[model samples]
Structure formats: structure tokens, C-alpha cells
Target chain A: MSRILVDNLVVTYPLFNRAKSSLDTQTAPLDAGEDFGGAHKRLVRDRRGYVTGVRALDGVSFRVEEGERIGLVGANGSGKTTLLQVLAGIYLPAQGRVRVEGRTTSLVNINLGMSSEATGNKNITLRGLASGRTRSEIEARRTEIAAFAGLGEFIDLPVSTYSAGMRMRLNFAIATAFEPEVLILDEWLSAGDAKFRKAAAKRMVEFVGQAGILILASHSASLLQENCTRGLWLDDGQLRFDGPIEEVLKAYEQDGNRLVGAAARA
Target chain B: MTPTTKIYDPHAARGVSGFLSDLWVGLSMVELWRAFAWDEIQHRYRRSALGISWIVLSFLMFVAGVSFFFAGFSGRGVESFVAYVAIGYAAFIFITGNFVDGCQVFTSSSVWIKAVSLPYSVHVYRSLFRSLLTFFLQMVVVIPILVWAGIRPGAVTLLFVPAVLVYLLNAVAVQYLLGLVAARFQDIGHLVTSIVRLMIFVTPILWVREGLEGARALAADLNPLTHYVEIFRAPLLGEMPRSTSWLVVVVLTVAVWGVVAMVAAAFRRRLPYWL
Candidate 1:
């Protein structure tokens, strides 16, 4: 029953302009004539004498149902994170429609999930409850997570004391521990070494094999090609291409090289 | 299976009804806040030798220090003055704690907010639970202080229960209000902090409200904190709270919640964007 249907999703974030000691970035204009009326008005120069918003996702729409392993490939600031965020219910769309019909958990930011002060064992409990899993579900997965994470005796230690790789392992294990119907991941897999990544990918594929959805946004081409069967390529906040993983990545890389080559000739 | 259609449209009409349903949904998830609040409390004490006991020790010290110095200044009997200040200061700190904490509630939880799709009110409840836990832990000292003041516990003392229930109800709404406001405007956080610090002087925690006159009496009357403190403090002192205090409490609660409904309707979704 888990499904995602997004229709013309648009999202915008304000650009805080500080003329003084802060870094001042230029205001990106809003593309007009979309279905949204009030959101289009937000980008006009305000009393602060600055264009207020950058449209992160502009009318990008797609749909996915149970058991789809989709890879999102895009450059920085190309709305990859924003799309995942909308799916995970972090950011509400400014216009259009988005329906997510299941329990979804996102590992978009690795630094965010675990409390550094809490022990790894406790974080699993805390995170499990936050995800609305039953107590028995959490207890059932606790040992398996420990074994998968390879934390061993380190599970009893506070997360603050662990190294970055250790935390990433724990986070990955904990997130995949209890099976959320829809799982969204960002580039957190890059934090681990190749062996850890291999083990994690095996777990993810196995998890998705059980009729769960996986939407992963990562910068690594190998990670996407190895795990995802489908791909979404985003450019400048627009959905540029969507198809088989190889074809999408091929178009995405060619366009990147084309832009760079054009710049060099200029 | 019912699909959860979460939508945002600029043209969608949001009024009081929209906010109430949003509040209802968030408030229903009690399990989320309980786990988060308990984790937060433990997180606060991590790596510290004194651990959770510091909450008790420091609260007792604050009550001893503040009540002792201000006891003679009130021109009231020392024991009664201790009792008044103890109860009044505890209430003052609790109220202001909610005010200050509510302002930073969302911004502080920006990490979790971005990572999870948990309801915004979960943060409000989490902050409220932590503040109430701390306040309750500190309020434990009030019992022994009341004994030291020679005040006998009676049926009237039970009034503290209802007063606190009202206090908590107002807290959820107020926290939602300030958390939204301060997240978008960073300056408001400092403004709220300074205003709370100034409140200690204007709200009559250390001094007697009964003896004031002229401008001083007017300040006490106009200050809403005066009524909030009295409603909680008056009960523990074994007297019925003044009818004016009850009226002010009820009226302010409604007014604040009314503002919350409007603000939530307009700004709740935009709040995450602002942060």
C-alpha cells in the first residue's frame, strides 16, 4: 500500500542578505506562471531591498510505488535533497500536490540522527520509538543491528566517544533496523570505507527485496549503479531526465562536461 | 489503505479550524515527546559527575540564597517572607523558563526537524516536558520551605493542581507561538531574554505586591507575570488565589491561544523554511 505521488511540487527558501560581515549571495529569480500565486509574490524585492527566495524545487513531479529502488543523481543545489525532503515529509511543497502513503524515515543528514551523549544502545531505542516502531520490533532488531554495525563492545559506549565511521555504521544499522515502508537516504554512505559500503548495500538490497521502497540520493556514481535500477537526474531545480540508471547517468555526465567545455571555449 | 495526502497550497484557506486539527494531530503523539524528553534530560547530565542530582542541589541552593537575603527586606515576618519568596520564585522561574525555552525550541531542534517529519508540536511538548520536569524537581524544595515557614498543609493547598494544569495548557500554546516567532527572527531571542531578565524586577518575586502603591502598584497590576506567579504561589501559601488573579489567568490563556490559532494557520508551514 505504500506509494508516493507528487504533482508539480515546488519549494523555495529565503536568501538572507546581510550587506555587512556576512557572505552575500545573489538572489535567484522566481520563474513565473506556475500554478502558485502567493509563492510567486514572495520573490519580489521586499523592504530589505533584496529578492527574498530561491526556488529549490520548481514544479518537479514523479511517482513511485512499493519496491522501487530509485537513485537520485544531481550536482550540489540541484534540488536532490529537497525532493527527498519532500518525500520524507520534512519540507511541505509550496504549490501542487504530494502524497506519501506510508511510514517514511530519512537518513538525509548523518550528523543529525544520534544523540552524541547517549549510548549507541540507547540511541537505537530512542530512534526506534521516534519512528513509531513497537517495543518488540525495536528489541528484535537490537542485536541484529549491533552485529551489522560491527560496534561489538562499543555499543555500550556513548556515541560521542565513537569515531565518525563508527557513528555512521551505527546510524545506518539503526535506520535500516526496523523496516519503515519507505526509506530515503542521502550521501551518508560515502562516510564509510568500501567494505562497509558493500555490507550496507547488501543490507539495503535485501531490505528493498521485501517489498519496501528505497529512494537514495548520492553523489557516487558507483553507489547508484550498483544498487539502484532506476535513476532521476535533476539539473537547476528541474527534473532533467528519468530512466534506466546508466542512461540517466550518461546524460547527466555529458551535460556536466558540455557546460564545462562551453565555459572553457568562452 | 488511506494515502496521507500532505499538501501545501498558497491559496489554501487556513483559519482557526486548520490550527486546531494540526494541534490535535501533534498532541496525539504523546509517545514521541516522552521518549525525546527523557533522552534530552539524560543528554543534559552526560559526562557530569553529579549527574541528575545537580538539579536538586542547585535548586535548593537558589531557594536558600534568594530567600535568605530578601527575607528581611520585605518587612514581613522572616518565616512567612521565606515561604512567599520560595513559592513565588519557583513559579517565576518556571514561567520564564517556558518563555525563554519556547523561543529556542525549534531552532535548537533544527537538526531533528530537518531529519524527521515529526510534528512541530512534538518539539513544543518535548521542551514543555523538560521544563516541567525541572520545575517540578525544583518545586520539591517548596514543601520543606513551607514547613519551615510554619504553614500547615490543608485542603486549600490542593488548588496547586488545577493551577498547574492551566499553566501547562497555556505553555503548549505559548511555546508554539514563540518557537515560530524566534526561529525566523534571531533578534527576538535576545529581546525575549532581556525582557525575561527585566521581568524579575517588575513582577514582584522578591518584594511584596500588597504594600506597593502609585506607579509601583500599576506595574504589578499591568504585568501578566504577577498573576501567573500568584495563581501558583498563592495556593501553596494556603490561601485562595485572588479572584482577579484567576480572571487574569483565564483571560490571558484564551487570548494567547487565540493568537496561536491565527499564527499557526498563517505561519506553521513557513516556519521550517524560515529556519
Candidate 2:
């Protein structure tokens, strides 16, 4: 069974000052009291008053079980990606307990390691190997991936020549090619035209219907509502709401509107 | 029971076992790094008419030009001097290449590092393999030089293989050490580039180590690089390497790995955040 349990997770990432990170400027001028606004209140400073790091995820907790389709809604840099990455085992949380039980595949970024200079066919080989596929395994699925992408002759050409929609087709096809008990995605797929969309929806149904887990982060309300039964709304690295998709999306929209109104008045 | 469940905790570390497992996993994924390294090589020379011959061409140019220019200064026969320059220079290139490549191995692969959850040793092996490929290519010219200089393969020459294995062994440790340090601190990258360039001169690639009488001799003796070079060069030239060189290299390998184990243990989990 696919399951995820995260408890009181805290992830703090270091933020080195530009001058301090540069080779020429080893000893940089100190920033004594540089303050950032809003969500950045979680930034940590050293005893010497220099900004040390930012608490990307602070005390966030969630649990996921089989057959649950979760839609994560959050503003940019609100730690939606970080949470997804943590689940994907890319970044380990600094202080927390996380247990993931399943073969988890994270398509967190569509173009995570895509090389523009390599052909669509070559990319399939590259991605397959990078994700731990052996030569024979990649060869077994090469033709299937090419047919799914529908790039045809362009599969032999470098990705640089492919149209944006075509590139997305290849990326989506390659990522979703393999089946997994748990899959994480950064955004909902809305690639190509009606035919591709129909195929993608079918693929999604097949995976979600297999007693697996799907955690998707997207801004589109309709997409989330159509595919996901539950929602997780994150605000500034904190879980603001978790419930039915309708209620979570409602709360998220209201918060956005309230912030807009507050800004207008100021 | 399902065998697929995996747990990751940033705060928890398994110390030596974790490091060993990581190395094992990365080494097992040979196809991953090998494919990427091959692709990188193809991209580098894909458009050129000479293709991968550029490595061989460059090696030939450097060794030929240097040997001819400095042949009289070797205080040795011109024929012997030629092979010595060819082998010594190639070893220098290989050693220095590993050092320079080590600094960029992790930093260059930051995209993959952030996107995927693979062992950090993958990049280490990838960079080392790239250097190894170039070193193999440089050998194309070295063989001809050896043949021309009348050095034939003998039982003593078999020692060259293990001497090279020692270098590769050292390279893995050095790569993990330098790759991690340089990724965390940008200044180390610059420092490494400078030190690598300085190493070219400090190492006796063009100059022979035979006639140095005083401090020069002591410096050569102290330089671990001199030992590494001697271990490889002495065997290929059908001479036995000094026991001191072999002892220094083995001891240094253990010491460097000891340091790498501690550093990697402390910072392996923090690698993603730093990038």
C-alpha cells in the first residue's frame, strides 16, 4: 500500500550573501539588520546579525494514504515545491519524521534535467538512466515513449528545435511512462490539444484507480476540482487549510482577495 | 510485506555505513554516469570534423612542443627524454584534470542534484570517468613515443596497471573531498584552479628529478604528486619505483579517505541545501 506520513516537519535552507559566496570577495561587508517582509519573518540570523537561513517548511504536517488524490494550492515560494520535493526524497527535512511506503516517482519539475541539445529519443535514454533504469529497461520502453510523445521525426532531432508544446508532450510522456505506487507532480498537465488531453486524463485515471496516491500542486481550480478529492492549501510555508477541495479552494481564494483589498487600502 | 518503502531523515546519519552504501549505490549505477559522460563528450566534439580526435591532437601538440623545446635541458639523451616527457606530461594532465574536474563535479550538476535523489558519488564518478577517457585518448600518442624510444612491454611494465589503479583509488576520495568542499565554498573553486596551475610547474613534468641536489630534491620527495607520478612513470619506463613513493601513495590514500569519511558524514545530507 502507498502511504506517506510527515510529522512536524521543519526544513531550513541556508542563504549565503552574494559577496560572501563570490571567489574575489571572500571577506564581504556585513549586513547587520537586513529585514525582509511578510513570509520571510521566518528567516534566521546568526548571533553576529547576519542572515543565516530561511525556514522553508516550519512545523508542517500531513498524512497520505492509498487512493487519495491531493491537490496542493499555494502562492509562489510558499513551500509547495519544497514539500513535494521532501516527499519525493529530494530534500530531507531538517527536523521531522517522514515515512514513505511505496515506489514513489516525482515529476516535480517537467524540465528537471532535460537537455535542450539532446534529441527527444536521447532524452528518453538520459532520463531513464538518471532515474535508475538500466539500458535494457530503457530500450524496452523507448518506442513506447516515442509513440506517446507523438514527436515523430522530431524525436530524432534535438529538443532545441521542438516547439514548446511538443517539448511538454515529450516530458510528460517520459515522466508518466513508468507506473508508480506514489506520484508527485508540480503542476497539472494541460499540454497539446484535445486528443493529447484525453489521453493524459485516461493515464491519470489508470494510475489513481490502481489504489495509488497522487499529490499534485497546481494553480488551476478546475483542474484540481476535477481530479482531486482533497486539497492542501499552504501559505508562507504553513498548512493553512486541509479538507474537501471546495472548502480549501474557497479559503485560499478568500485569503487572496483579502490580501488584495488590504493592499488597495494601504 | 512490500519491499519498496524508503525513509529519509535529514537529522539522522548512519556515518561510515551510509557513506559506504552511497558509494556502492553510485558505483552500481554505472549506466547513468557513463551515459551522461558519453553525451557530454559527444556534445563537445559533435560539430567538429575531427570529433574525439581533438583530445589526442591536443595531447600530441603539447607533448611534442614541450619535448622539442626543452629536450636539451633534460641532461639526458634526447630519445629517452622524449618518452619521459610524453608519459610524465600525460600523467600530469590526468592528475591535474581530476583535481580541476573534482571542483566542478557537484557544482556543475546542481540541476540534477536538486531535481533528483541520487548518490552524490554519481557526479564524482562521472567527472573522474571524463578525465579517464581523456587520459586514455592521450595514451594513443604515448604508445608511439614509447615504441620510438625503444621501451618494450616487460614484467616490470605490468606494475604500471596497479600504479594507475592506485591513482584511480585516490581520485575517488579526492573527488568526493574536493567536490563537496568546492560546492559549499565558492572560493575553494578559485583556489583549486590556481593550485592546479601552480601544480603544473611544481611537478617535474618537463624537468627531470634526477639531478636536483638540495632543497629541490627535498621538495620533490615531500610532494605526494611526485610520488604518484613516479609510481606510474617508473613502471612504464621499465624501472622500479622507489619504495618510499609506493608507501607515501598508499598512506596518503588512506588518510585522504579518512578525512572524506568525516566530511561526507557531516555534510552529505546538507548537500542539496548548499546547492
Candidate 3:
């Protein structure tokens, strides 16, 4: 069956309130009757203060079929997060279209709906509902979600009292409680302690086995190899390569090390 | 698999269903309001001795202070002053808090804004709802004080219901526009704070409009907030409403600002990077 599709997506964002220099101010009094030479000089100085736009995503296109696990690999600012945001419907594309089938849940920012002052139990309710779970569903699975988080007595206490790891556990538990048709995971997936890590890994494996589509964006090769069946490499807001996970990983490593070696020699 | 032969049709799964689903989800502002308000109250008094009772006590203190100050200055009887200032200040607090907080509603929750793809109207509605809850709680003080002071509210007091509703709608619209503007221009937050302070004096909160003669009275009558205050205060204090013209002004203001806010929110894609 068909799943998510993105076609020639282009998202541009404007940079507002650009800083102006004194040179730009001097040009403000230049009237039409001023000499052409002085006017040219004023125009040159004024250009420095003009605001500019940044293209976050430029003509990116990709697709994911049902029951597929795709790893989106890229360096920082490679449009990975932007692509995820677009897919999650947080950012509308400046150009192009994105379509997805079935229910989608994004773990892009795990602690998003959580209130720091609320008890862990209360946050479970709020964040769970925020992530698209029905009230009855959250109620039915509260115990299981809490248990999986391993927060123990702290779950009853205010979340502000919990350590960072504890908070992440709670967030992870709430996010994964519902079985979404499509799951989008950001860099936050590898958080928490070793024991929690093992449990999280097991939970992810269980989730992947249930015939859902997964799109993970991460820089870690081992994580991608372990979790994804296919890979798409991105560079500077464009898709660089797409292939089997192992082949793409090999190509990325070769190019990556070559740049490192050349820099070292230089 | 042949990389070229296995060409994926990128637009195969595109649909408008997701947008419609998000619109439905955005309408859950009431639930979000209840949840957040409970969290605010619980956190505020989590370890306090009297807990939620502090909400009542503080509101009483505010009314008492305003009533006494305005009573002495305006030379009105204690009973009339108490009834008038108590309800007037209560409504003012609701209106001011909503307007001030609404400006930062989106900016303060930048995390949630970036994380979820729901319609931006949810944030606006959620903030308005929370302010309404606080206002409702504060109204508890107004009722008893009015009754104890022997203020015989007239049938026109029923008008307070619609008046409050209009005030609320106006607050939401103003907040939506201000919030979007503040998101782009960080200076708008500080500007809104200063403006709200000025608005309190201009809106005739503690003083009666009747005290101001001719031109000043005309200005007071024409003020958008004057209509809100007088509509509720007149009936509760047993004075006739100044004019129904304020209702028309309120409706027009809401419609104009509502359109501006929706346009701003519809174009929020430009905002993430602006921030």
C-alpha cells in the first residue's frame, strides 16, 4: 500500500529586522536632484542594510512505502530537521506538496506538551492527548506507560523534581504509547541511561515489527544500521543519495573520511 | 533493485485529509485550557497552607484596596463605591490580563509552536480560555461583595453576560494580532506592557464616566473598553447603560482584528525563521 509522498518541496523563510550601519543612514537624505555619482555611492552603501531570505529546503523529494523503515542521514543544517518538520505539518512548504496516508505521530520534540510544574502523571495525560491519544486510551494505558518509563515514585511527584533522564523517559513513554501508522523521530531517540536505553530499543523494535512506517533522522551509523532498512543522505537542503542502508552508509563514510584526511594534510 | 526502474511517485500519497484532521484537533482548546489552568493552580499552591483559597483571598484584597481608594477620592458612599469598584476592577483585570498575556502566548510557548502542526488559533483560544477561568474565579469575590453592600442589581445586569462575551472576543482578536506581531518584532512585548498600563487609566476602571463632563465624557463613552466596563457596571450598580453604540464598535473591532490575526497565523511558516 502507498504511504508518505513529498514532491519537489521548497520552503523559504524570511530574515527580519536586519541591522543597518551608519553608512546606510547617510544615503537617506540623498534627493533625486543629487549628483548621479553621489547617488551611486549612496545606493551601494544602502544595499548593505537590506534584509535577506534563507532557503531552508530546496527542491527536496522523497517517498516512503508502507511497512518501511527509512533512515534520513545528514550533517547539521542538511535540511533533516526541516524535512521532518514539513512532514509533521509544522511548516508549510513555500513550494511543492507533501502527502501522507494513515495516522502520523512525530517524536521530533519529545517533551513538547509537557508542563515542568505538573506531576509526571498529569504530564502523561496532557502530552498523551497532545500527541493524538484519546482520553480513554491514555487512561487505559497509563499504568503501562508509567511502568515502561521506570520513573518509580517520581511519577507521582512534580516533573520539575525529576532528573533530565527521568523526564526524557516519561516523554518517550508517552510518545510511544499509541501505535501510529507513521512515526518521525529526531535526534532525541538515543537519550537516557543504559537500562532505559535497552528498554527503549526493545520498544522501538516492537513498534517497527507491527508493519508501521518509520522515518528516522540521525547522524549515527550504528543506530541507522540497527533500525532502518533503507537510507537517504542529505547535504545542504538537497537529497544527495538514496539506496540500501549499508551501501549509503559506506558511501557517506568514504566521502566523510576523505574530507577529514584532506583537511588533516592541509 | 534498479534505482531508475524503481521510480517512486513522490506525490502518490498526498491528500487534504491531514489538514482537515489538524483543524479538528485545533478545536480542543477548551481541554487544553482546563488542563493548563489546573496545572497553574496546583503548582501555585502545591505546598501552601490554604491552597486554592489564596485565589479568593487575593481577589478580595484587590477589591478592598480599589474600593477604598476610589471611594475616598470620588467622595462616593462606601456601599456604592464597593459595589462599583469591585465589579469594575474584576472585569478590568480579566480584560487586561487577557490582552497582556495574549501578546506573549505564542512566543512563550515557542517549543509547542515548533513541535506541533495544529492550527495557530489553538494557542489564541487556549490563552483566552485560561484568562476566562481566572476571571470566573475572581468573579466569586464580586458577587458576595455586591450582595453584602446591598446593591440592588437591575434587570439590565443580564446584559453583562453578552457584554463579557463581546469583551472576550475582542481580547482574543487583539491578542492574535499582537501575538503574531510580537513574534516577529521582539520589541512588541515591551510595547504591549507599556500600552496596557496606559490603557488601564484610559478605560475608566476606578473612576465613573459621569464625573467627567462634556468632551471627556464623550471620549469615555466612545472608548471601546468603556462600553465593556459600563455595560457590566451600569446594571450591577443600577445605572442605565451609556449607549448601545459601543456594542457595534466592539463587533466591528473584533471582525477587523480577527481577519488580521487569521491572515498572520495562516502565514506562520514565515515566522519560525523570523524568530
Which candidate achieves the best TM-score against the true structure? 2
Q: Please write out the lDDT profile of model 1 over residues B1-275, one tens digit for every residue.
A: 23344554553336666667767766787876787788889878877999988978887787678777887778789888888887887788888988899999999888778877777888898899988887887788778878988899889899899889989989998899999999888888999999999999888787999887899898898899999989888878888888898899999999999898888888787776877
The candidate with the higher TM-score, 2 or 3, is 2
Ranking of all predicted structures according to TM-score, beginning with the best and ending with the worst:
2, 1, 3
Chain A TM-score for candidate 1 is 0.87
In Å, residue B45's CA in model 3 sits off its true spot by 3.8
**C-alpha RMSD in Å of predicted model 2 compared with the true structure:** 4.5
Give candidate 1 regions above 4 Å deviation: A18-49, B1-18
lDDT of 2 by residue, B164-258 (tens): 89889988998898888888898988898898888877787888898998999999888888998999998888889899999998999999999
RMSD of each: 4.5, 4.5, 7.9
State in Å the error of residue B210, model 1: 1.5
State the lDDT of candidate 3 residue by residue for B71-134, as single tens digits.
Answer: 7776578887887777887788777787688778788767667775545656777677767777
lDDT of 1 by residue, A184-234 (tens): 998878778999999989989998887778999988889999899999988
Model number with the top DockQ: 2
The superposed Cα distance between candidate 3 and the true structure at residue A135, in angstroms, equals 2.1
* TM-score of every candidate relative to the true structure: 0.90, 0.93, 0.85
DockQ-best of 2 and 3: 2
Q: TM-score: which is higher, 1 or 3?
A: 1
